[model samples]
Target: MTDSVFTRIVRREIPAAIVFEDEQVIAFMDAGQVNPGHVLVATKRQVETVMELAEAEAAHLFAVATRVAKVVQATFQPEGMTLLQTNKPAGWQTVPHVHVHVLPRYANDGAELVWPRKDPPLAELQALAARIVL
Candidate 1:
């Protein structure tokens, strides 16, 4: 994989509001604001999606995400926080590179995530769970 916008920022090839960085991952403020303290955690490598990341690389990315969540939680003092990661265009992943969105949430803040609830039959749900190896 070639360098992504995030990879460039990690390498200091582009200017970013970088909050934290290590050899494996980089955390920075989002260029666009979903919330006041929205942050993006991205891998230093150029893997395009979470599925593309090696196991070790994925672990490193999540570790950075966890740290960024703590910082955002403490500094912003939001009512809640959301960790979001989208994979591929079908999942609303705009960037080709893998990144996680650390969003600060508050009541009446208009950040709504709606999921249609369908109570699948108990047997179906059990079958699905059984199929999941993890």
Candidate 2:
């Protein structure tokens, strides 16, 4: 199997343009950025997907993402911003590591975030929510 580039970054075996770091998470400049201040927030635990994250860990990851997004917004002054999380190949995730992409956007950037929106019936939604709720 191939080595995990993010794991190498975490282990300091490879260099990343790190922006922030704490015990739980790390934020770094995306090597292929959508915009100038684009950043990636990743869990330090080396989980492959969000489903493996504990509730507290997930919360902390998002908190750090939000903080980093705010700085990117302020510093870069993009017209808008996007918080992106992906799962596996079906979800457009290229890397195996669980990471959140903070994409800074601008006017006429030509990026597309199209997805189907299903407006299901209220009862169906409620039933699905019930099934999903823990």
Give each prediction's root-mean-square deviation over alpha carbons: 1.7, 1.6
What is the TM-score (0 to 1) of candidate 2? 0.90
Residue pairs clashing, model 1: none
- Tens digits of lDDT, candidate 1, 32-103: 888899999988778778998889989888888988899899998999999999998988898888999999
Q: Could you tell me the lDDT of residue 12 within candidate 2?
A: 95
Each prediction's TM-score versus the true structure: 0.89, 0.90
Span of ten consecutive residues with least summed lDDT in model 1 = 1-10
**Deviation (Å) of 33 in candidate 1:** 1.3
Q: Can you write out model 2's per-residue Cα lDDT over 14-111, one digit (the tens) per residue?
A: 89999999999989999998789989999887878899999999999999999999999989999999999999899998988889999999888987
| Per-candidate clash tally | 0, 0
